[model samples]
Target chain A: MAVVVQFAIGLVFGLGLVIAGMSNPAKVLNFLDIGAIRSGGWDPSLAFVLAGAIAVTFIGFRLVLRAAQPVFGESFHLPGKTGIDARIVIGPAIFGVGWGLAGFCPGPAFTALATGGGAALMFVVAMMAGMGAARWLANRRA
Target chain B: MRRSLCALAGAAGPDSVNTEFTPFASFLGGALIGAAAVMLMATMGRIAGVSGIAVRLLPPYAGGDVAGRLAFILGLVAAPVVVMMVTGSAPDLHIEAGPALLVVAGLLVGFGAVWGNGCTSGHGVCGLSRLSPRSLVATGVFMATAIATVYLTRHLM
Candidate 1:
């Protein structure tokens, strides 16, 4: 059941990327490439993605909170931490730069594999290595 | 939007989905993901973490969580098929980069997920929904890094 839900989430997420224009390298470039923020040249379409995502989530959370127990298991598994730190700041910074540059994140990359697309597979491979490096950094504390 | 460009250029990065969508469309799509995450967790007692199940793709995953993993994966695969049916034609596949950079990009993403402990959907959607500090921070980092990388690669590099 959890697996089913997970995939459903991934599917929705991927489809959203497809729909929101986040999956597009050019659009994403427009979002990140702000120096030359042209009217239509510098597109902030992601704001729409953010807005839509938040709206649905806000309503969804209310509904989830009303439930006694989860459908597939027992309770909702939410994050526990609350403070800002080095890892948080640095890890995502690197990840973001990569995303903006590459225009691909893990979820979309995996979905792209289904299409046998070239960029998708390349990102997937690079993503694996990047993850490996991160693990090393985290474990090594270096 | 051209296939050869993604295959031939240096711009294609695995985010090919972005190639086909508009800002409004992706926003709606994200909501669906967010909704699915909320509903699945509320009713299914799960957290919609992709990496957890992906780990199962490794070993000793045969029976431990195979059924659920397959189901989840199948659901994702089925969606595009369904969308294709409804839309009449599927989105075209396109990337703006060559194979070398694509591989490098993928490695970075995978590494980032491992290091950050989750991906955009897991942290951005699910984590942010719970108001997790880590998720918020992670999301912040993800966006910031993306902006910086673009600067370095496109201009500085």
Candidate 2:
């Protein structure tokens, strides 16, 4: 039952990504291209997407977290590390460089895998390889 | 009056600026995504962070609901198919990166997202929603860098 629910949620999330135009590299690049504001070609649709998602989530988390426990889980498994750290900043900074280059973040990249043609396939594969390498390095350190 | 107002808004003509601004669609989609995150939290007590979820599915697997995570990803892959059935076509997606760039970008995205412990969905949406300071910092840094990168690549390069 929980799996079913997760599958449904994933479907909704992916559809949202598609409808929001995050799956389109051109649209994403336009948003990232802040200089386009001068040329009158800047697209601010991505900001709206973030605003809308965050608004709903903020309200939703407030209400949902109040419950004793989730409907299906034994306990809520939130992130453990709380303090700001170099890893948090440096890691996302690296991710940002990649995102700007291709406009393919993790969610949209995966969501685009099926229909985004061969380029999408190449990106996903390379992404998986990168993920594997990161995991290996982390394990070695720990 | 409307013409002047439009000019003030920098929208004097459809071609002038923001020709692709679909505020309504974007907002609706975002709401749906938020709803999905809420549902995941409500039902399973999991954060709907795509990078976190995807990384767990890789080798040296983390302990948790592996099957559930797989189902979620499979559903994501199937979403376009559903859209095609309902709307008679898949959503449009254009890849500006060639194979080499795609690979490089993919590596950075995969590694960075995992190392950082989140991505846009995780940090930008879920983390901000929870009002985590770490998330706020992470989001700010990434957004700034991403903007800078675009400017450098598209403008300076």
Candidate 3:
């Protein structure tokens, strides 16, 4: 039952990515291309996407978190760390470079795998490799 | 700064921005995504962070609900098909980066997202919704850097 719910949620998430035009790298690039604001080529669609998503999630979280525990789980698996650290800053900075370079964030990239052609496949594979490397390094440090 | 002024002056025209703007679709899609995140949290008590979920499925495997995670990913991959069925066409998708650039970008995205502990979904949506200060910082840094990168690539380069 839990797995089924997860799958359904994933499907909704993916469909959202598709409908939001996030699966399109060109569209994402247009949004990222702040320089184009001068020439009037900038796309503000992504901003709306972010705004809409955050609004819903904010309200939804407030409502759902009121309960003692989740419907299926004993305890919520929320992030506990609160400190602002170098890792948080440096890591996202690096990710931003990659995202701006290719316009493929994880969620959109995964959804794009269905019809995004060969480049999507290559990107996903390389991303997996990078994830593996990160995991390895973290384990070594631990 | 001068260019920003020009943009403001020209903002009245429909063609002033990218013509493909779909504010309605994007917002609806975003709402759906948010709903999904809420559902996941309400039901399973998990954060719907894609990078975190995907990384756990990798080797040197971190133990958790492996099957559930895989099912979620599989569902994501299947989304386009559903779109096709409903819309009578596949969703528009185009990758601008070349193979080499994509490989490099992919590695950076994977490593950075994993190292950072979240991506847009995790940090941008879930984190921000929870009003997490760490996420606010992360989102700000990444958005600034990403904008700079795009400027460098599209203009300076």
Predictions' DockQ, in order: 0.49, 0.57, 0.61
Steric clash pairs (candidate 2) = none
TM-score of 3: 0.92
lDDT of 1 by residue, B1-157 (tens): 3323543444433323222226657667667667666666676566666654454454445326577666665565555556677888665445654577666666666666766767776777777766787888888888877887765554444
True contacts kept of 1: 0.61
Instruction: Provide i-RMS per model in Å.
Output: 3.2, 2.7, 2.6
What is residue A130's positional error in candidate 2, in angstroms? 1.4
How accurate locally is residue A13 in candidate 1, as Cα lDDT from 0 to 100?
Answer: 60
Instruction: Give a tens-digit lDDT track for model 2, residues B55-144.
Output: 999865696789899889887888887988999988987776768888999999899888888999999999999988888988998898
Question: Model 3 misses residue A83 by how many Å?
Answer: 0.5
Model 3 misses residue A76 by how many Å? Answer: 0.3
Classified by CAPRI criteria, candidate 1 counts as acceptable
> Model 3: per-residue lDDT, tens digit, B1-157?
4434533443211112244889999999999999999999999888999999999998655858898999889889989989999889998876657788789899999988988889899999999999999899889888888888877666554
Q: Order the candidate numbers by lDDT, best to worst.
A: 3, 2, 1
For model 3, how does the per-residue alpha-carbon lDDT over A1-142 read when each residue is reduced to its tens digit? 9888889999999999988988888788889887787777888899989988999999999899999999988988999999998889988998898898888989988998878889899999999888788778877887
What is the lDDT of every predicted structure here?
Answer: 0.63, 0.85, 0.86
Error of 1 at A71 (Å): 1.2
* Alpha carbon lDDT at A53, candidate 2: 95
TM-score of B-chain for each predicted structure, in order? 0.76, 0.86, 0.86
